[model samples]
Target: MDKEFTPRIAAILCQWCSYTGADLAGTSRLQYPTSIIAMKVMCSSRVDPVLLLKAYLSGSDGVLLGGCHPGDCHYEVGNYHTRRRFAILKAVFDTLGLESARLKLSWISASEGPKFAQVANDYTEEIKKMGENPSKKKMFL
Candidate 1:
Protein backbone atom coordinates (compact mmCIF):
# COMPACT_ATOMS: atom_id res chain seq x y z
CA MET A 1 0.00 0.00 0.00
CA ASP A 2 1.16 3.54 -0.64
CA LYS A 3 2.27 5.25 2.58
CA GLU A 4 0.25 8.37 1.75
CA PHE A 5 -2.85 6.33 1.01
CA THR A 6 -2.90 4.36 4.22
CA PRO A 7 -6.33 4.37 5.82
CA ARG A 8 -6.77 6.29 9.05
CA ILE A 9 -8.69 4.33 11.67
CA ALA A 10 -10.09 5.86 14.82
CA ALA A 11 -10.62 3.30 17.56
CA ILE A 12 -12.42 3.52 20.87
CA LEU A 13 -11.39 0.76 23.29
CA CYS A 14 -12.64 -0.26 26.69
CA GLN A 15 -9.93 0.29 29.22
CA TRP A 16 -10.49 -2.95 31.11
CA CYS A 17 -10.13 -5.24 28.14
CA SER A 18 -9.37 -3.88 24.71
CA TYR A 19 -7.01 -1.19 25.90
CA THR A 20 -5.15 -3.65 28.07
CA GLY A 21 -4.96 -6.03 25.18
CA ALA A 22 -3.53 -3.26 23.00
CA ASP A 23 -1.01 -2.45 25.71
CA LEU A 24 -0.04 -6.08 25.79
CA ALA A 25 0.35 -6.04 22.03
CA GLY A 26 2.70 -3.10 22.34
CA THR A 27 4.72 -4.66 25.14
CA SER A 28 4.90 -7.94 23.26
CA ARG A 29 5.90 -6.06 20.11
CA LEU A 30 3.19 -7.70 18.06
CA GLN A 31 3.18 -6.24 14.57
CA TYR A 32 0.03 -4.51 13.38
CA PRO A 33 -0.96 -1.51 11.28
CA THR A 34 0.02 1.84 12.75
CA SER A 35 -3.04 3.31 11.08
CA ILE A 36 -5.08 2.82 14.24
CA ILE A 37 -5.47 5.85 16.52
CA ALA A 38 -6.86 4.45 19.76
CA MET A 39 -8.75 6.23 22.49
CA LYS A 40 -9.45 4.58 25.83
CA VAL A 41 -12.85 4.61 27.49
CA MET A 42 -14.18 3.05 30.68
CA CYS A 43 -16.67 0.90 28.82
CA SER A 44 -17.81 0.28 25.31
CA SER A 45 -21.25 1.56 26.22
CA ARG A 46 -19.73 4.98 26.69
CA VAL A 47 -18.88 5.30 23.01
CA ASP A 48 -21.64 7.63 21.87
CA PRO A 49 -22.93 7.29 18.34
CA VAL A 50 -22.13 10.91 17.62
CA LEU A 51 -18.49 10.34 18.54
CA LEU A 52 -18.20 7.66 15.91
CA LEU A 53 -19.85 9.83 13.29
CA LYS A 54 -17.58 12.65 14.19
CA ALA A 55 -14.57 10.44 13.66
CA TYR A 56 -15.57 9.60 10.12
CA LEU A 57 -16.50 13.21 9.42
CA SER A 58 -13.09 14.23 10.69
CA GLY A 59 -11.38 12.14 8.02
CA SER A 60 -11.07 8.71 9.56
CA ASP A 61 -11.50 6.07 6.88
CA GLY A 62 -12.87 3.66 9.49
CA VAL A 63 -13.94 3.47 13.10
CA LEU A 64 -13.35 0.51 15.41
CA LEU A 65 -14.93 -0.21 18.76
CA GLY A 66 -13.34 -2.84 20.99
CA GLY A 67 -14.65 -4.14 24.24
CA CYS A 68 -15.04 -7.26 26.34
CA HIS A 69 -16.95 -10.24 25.04
CA PRO A 70 -20.64 -10.65 25.74
CA GLY A 71 -21.17 -11.62 29.38
CA ASP A 72 -17.58 -10.69 30.07
CA CYS A 73 -17.86 -6.94 30.41
CA HIS A 74 -16.35 -5.53 33.56
CA TYR A 75 -19.44 -3.38 33.86
CA GLU A 76 -21.70 -6.39 33.60
CA VAL A 77 -24.11 -5.31 30.84
CA GLY A 78 -21.91 -2.71 29.22
CA ASN A 79 -20.99 -4.70 26.18
CA TYR A 80 -24.58 -5.73 25.71
CA HIS A 81 -25.60 -2.11 25.62
CA THR A 82 -22.79 -1.48 23.18
CA ARG A 83 -24.04 -4.26 20.99
CA ARG A 84 -27.50 -2.73 20.86
CA ARG A 85 -26.16 0.75 20.27
CA PHE A 86 -23.96 -0.46 17.46
CA ALA A 87 -26.90 -2.17 15.84
CA ILE A 88 -28.81 1.08 15.84
CA LEU A 89 -25.76 2.94 14.73
CA LYS A 90 -25.31 0.59 11.81
CA ALA A 91 -28.86 1.24 10.74
CA VAL A 92 -28.23 4.95 10.88
CA PHE A 93 -25.11 4.51 8.81
CA ASP A 94 -27.10 2.67 6.18
CA THR A 95 -29.82 5.30 6.18
CA LEU A 96 -27.21 8.00 5.72
CA GLY A 97 -25.74 6.27 2.66
CA LEU A 98 -22.61 5.31 4.51
CA GLU A 99 -21.05 1.89 4.22
CA SER A 100 -21.63 -0.05 7.42
CA ALA A 101 -18.50 -2.04 6.69
CA ARG A 102 -16.45 1.02 7.63
CA LEU A 103 -17.30 0.43 11.26
CA LYS A 104 -16.18 -2.65 13.18
CA LEU A 105 -16.81 -4.02 16.63
CA SER A 106 -14.60 -6.62 18.27
CA TRP A 107 -14.30 -8.35 21.60
CA ILE A 108 -10.80 -8.47 22.98
CA SER A 109 -9.78 -9.77 26.35
CA ALA A 110 -6.87 -8.46 28.36
CA SER A 111 -4.95 -11.61 27.58
CA GLU A 112 -5.58 -11.41 23.84
CA GLY A 113 -2.65 -9.40 22.59
CA PRO A 114 -2.23 -11.43 19.42
CA LYS A 115 -5.93 -11.15 18.74
CA PHE A 116 -5.76 -7.39 19.06
CA ALA A 117 -2.95 -7.23 16.56
CA GLN A 118 -4.79 -9.48 14.18
CA VAL A 119 -7.96 -7.45 14.43
CA ALA A 120 -6.02 -4.28 13.78
CA ASN A 121 -4.40 -5.77 10.71
CA ASP A 122 -7.64 -7.17 9.36
CA TYR A 123 -9.63 -4.00 9.88
CA THR A 124 -6.90 -1.88 8.34
CA GLU A 125 -6.83 -4.08 5.25
CA GLU A 126 -10.61 -3.98 4.99
CA ILE A 127 -10.63 -0.18 5.19
CA LYS A 128 -7.90 -0.02 2.58
CA LYS A 129 -10.12 -1.90 0.16
CA MET A 130 -13.07 0.35 0.97
CA GLY A 131 -11.02 3.50 0.39
CA GLU A 132 -11.66 6.80 2.23
CA ASN A 133 -14.75 7.57 4.25
CA PRO A 134 -17.40 9.30 2.17
CA SER A 135 -18.42 11.50 5.10
CA LYS A 136 -15.21 13.41 4.60
CA LYS A 137 -16.68 14.80 1.41
CA LYS A 138 -19.03 17.03 3.37
CA MET A 139 -18.12 19.81 5.77
CA PHE A 140 -19.12 19.30 9.38
CA LEU A 141 -20.20 22.24 11.47
Candidate 2:
Protein backbone atom coordinates (compact mmCIF):
# COMPACT_ATOMS: atom_id res chain seq x y z
CA MET A 1 0.00 0.00 0.00
CA ASP A 2 1.12 3.51 -0.73
CA LYS A 3 0.92 6.39 1.77
CA GLU A 4 -1.08 9.46 0.85
CA PHE A 5 0.30 12.90 1.75
CA THR A 6 -2.32 15.50 0.93
CA PRO A 7 -4.12 17.34 3.72
CA ARG A 8 -7.21 19.52 3.84
CA ILE A 9 -7.07 22.39 6.31
CA ALA A 10 -9.38 25.27 7.23
CA ALA A 11 -7.86 28.56 8.22
CA ILE A 12 -10.01 31.21 9.92
CA LEU A 13 -8.07 34.40 9.63
CA CYS A 14 -8.83 37.74 11.22
CA GLN A 15 -8.96 40.38 8.52
CA TRP A 16 -6.79 42.74 10.51
CA CYS A 17 -3.79 40.64 11.25
CA SER A 18 -3.55 37.12 10.07
CA TYR A 19 -5.43 37.58 6.83
CA THR A 20 -3.15 40.42 5.85
CA GLY A 21 -0.22 38.25 6.64
CA ALA A 22 -1.64 35.63 4.37
CA ASP A 23 -2.01 38.25 1.66
CA LEU A 24 1.58 39.23 2.18
CA ALA A 25 2.48 35.61 1.83
CA GLY A 26 0.81 35.66 -1.55
CA THR A 27 2.46 38.81 -2.83
CA SER A 28 5.81 37.57 -1.61
CA ARG A 29 5.24 34.35 -3.49
CA LEU A 30 5.96 32.25 -0.45
CA GLN A 31 4.61 28.87 -1.40
CA TYR A 32 2.48 26.89 0.99
CA PRO A 33 -0.19 24.27 0.67
CA THR A 34 -3.22 25.22 -1.38
CA SER A 35 -5.41 22.99 0.71
CA ILE A 36 -6.31 25.71 3.18
CA ILE A 37 -9.78 27.21 2.88
CA ALA A 38 -9.40 30.64 4.36
CA MET A 39 -12.37 32.14 6.15
CA LYS A 40 -11.94 35.83 6.74
CA VAL A 41 -13.38 37.44 9.85
CA MET A 42 -13.08 40.92 11.23
CA CYS A 43 -11.43 39.72 14.38
CA SER A 44 -10.39 36.46 15.94
CA SER A 45 -12.41 37.44 18.95
CA ARG A 46 -15.37 37.32 16.69
CA VAL A 47 -14.86 33.61 15.99
CA ASP A 48 -17.73 31.90 17.70
CA PRO A 49 -17.24 28.41 19.04
CA VAL A 50 -20.24 27.24 17.08
CA LEU A 51 -18.60 28.27 13.83
CA LEU A 52 -15.53 26.25 14.68
CA LEU A 53 -17.58 23.13 15.26
CA LYS A 54 -19.49 23.75 12.05
CA ALA A 55 -16.26 23.71 10.09
CA TYR A 56 -15.34 20.32 11.51
CA LEU A 57 -18.75 18.97 10.68
CA SER A 58 -18.30 20.33 7.18
CA GLY A 59 -15.22 18.15 6.37
CA SER A 60 -12.19 20.22 7.23
CA ASP A 61 -9.67 18.04 9.06
CA GLY A 62 -8.25 20.98 10.95
CA VAL A 63 -9.18 24.55 11.93
CA LEU A 64 -6.81 27.42 12.53
CA LEU A 65 -8.05 30.71 14.04
CA GLY A 66 -5.72 33.50 13.15
CA GLY A 67 -5.75 36.72 15.15
CA CYS A 68 -3.93 39.87 16.02
CA HIS A 69 -1.17 40.03 18.56
CA PRO A 70 -2.22 40.84 22.10
CA GLY A 71 -3.04 44.54 22.44
CA ASP A 72 -2.96 45.06 18.71
CA CYS A 73 -6.53 44.68 17.64
CA HIS A 74 -7.80 47.37 15.31
CA TYR A 75 -11.08 46.93 17.03
CA GLU A 76 -9.44 47.58 20.37
CA VAL A 77 -9.09 44.56 22.63
CA GLY A 78 -10.68 42.10 20.23
CA ASN A 79 -7.71 39.79 20.54
CA TYR A 80 -7.98 40.00 24.29
CA HIS A 81 -11.49 38.70 24.02
CA THR A 82 -10.36 35.97 21.65
CA ARG A 83 -7.79 34.81 24.17
CA ARG A 84 -10.59 34.15 26.61
CA ARG A 85 -12.89 32.62 24.03
CA PHE A 86 -10.30 30.24 22.58
CA ALA A 87 -9.61 28.85 26.05
CA ILE A 88 -13.22 27.91 26.61
CA LEU A 89 -13.74 26.59 23.08
CA LYS A 90 -10.67 24.39 23.40
CA ALA A 91 -12.01 23.03 26.67
CA VAL A 92 -15.29 22.12 25.07
CA PHE A 93 -13.62 20.45 22.12
CA ASP A 94 -11.56 18.44 24.58
CA THR A 95 -14.60 17.41 26.58
CA LEU A 96 -16.10 16.17 23.35
CA GLY A 97 -12.96 14.02 22.84
CA LEU A 98 -11.99 15.70 19.60
CA GLU A 99 -8.32 15.79 18.73
CA SER A 100 -6.98 18.97 20.35
CA ALA A 101 -4.49 19.23 17.54
CA ARG A 102 -7.37 19.75 15.14
CA LEU A 103 -7.82 23.27 16.50
CA LYS A 104 -5.16 25.93 16.59
CA LEU A 105 -4.91 29.68 17.25
CA SER A 106 -2.16 31.84 15.81
CA TRP A 107 -1.29 35.53 15.80
CA ILE A 108 0.25 36.72 12.59
CA SER A 109 0.72 40.41 12.00
CA ALA A 110 0.19 42.02 8.59
CA SER A 111 3.93 42.53 8.18
CA GLU A 112 4.93 38.98 8.99
CA GLY A 113 4.75 37.17 5.67
CA PRO A 114 7.26 34.55 6.70
CA LYS A 115 5.40 33.97 9.92
CA PHE A 116 2.22 33.20 8.05
CA ALA A 117 4.02 30.78 5.75
CA GLN A 118 5.63 29.03 8.67
CA VAL A 119 2.40 28.74 10.57
CA ALA A 120 0.55 27.26 7.61
CA ASN A 121 3.38 24.86 6.95
CA ASP A 122 3.63 23.81 10.57
CA TYR A 123 -0.10 23.32 10.92
CA THR A 124 -0.19 21.22 7.78
CA GLU A 125 2.47 18.99 9.32
CA GLU A 126 0.66 18.79 12.65
CA ILE A 127 -2.61 17.62 11.16
CA LYS A 128 -0.69 15.08 9.14
CA LYS A 129 0.59 13.64 12.40
CA MET A 130 -2.97 13.45 13.65
CA GLY A 131 -3.88 11.52 10.50
CA GLU A 132 -7.46 11.40 9.27
CA ASN A 133 -9.99 12.56 11.81
CA PRO A 134 -12.17 9.70 12.94
CA SER A 135 -15.23 11.84 12.37
CA LYS A 136 -14.33 11.76 8.72
CA LYS A 137 -15.23 8.09 8.73
CA LYS A 138 -18.86 8.93 9.29
CA MET A 139 -19.03 11.62 6.66
CA PHE A 140 -21.27 10.61 3.78
CA LEU A 141 -20.45 11.44 0.21
Top candidate by TM-score = 1
> After aligning candidate 2 to the native by TM-score, how far in Å is the CA of 99 from where it should be?
0.8
Error of 1 at 104 (Å): 0.9
Q: What is the lDDT of residue 84 in candidate 2?
A: 87
Error of 2 at 35 (Å): 1.9
Assess candidate 2 and give its lDDT: 0.85
lDDT of 1 by residue, 1-141 (tens): 444678889989999999999999999999999899999999999998788877877878999999999999998999999999999999998997778898899999999999999999999988888887766777653
* Superposed Cα RMSD, model 2: 2.0
How high is the CA lDDT of each candidate model?
0.91, 0.85
Give candidate 2 misplaced runs (Cα > 4 Å). Answer: 139-141
Cα-based RMSD of the predictions, in order?
A: 1.8, 2.0
TM-score of 1: 0.92
- Candidate 1 lowest-lDDT run of ten: 132-141
Using lDDT, give the best candidate's number: 1
- Residue 96 in model 1: shift from native, Å? 3.0
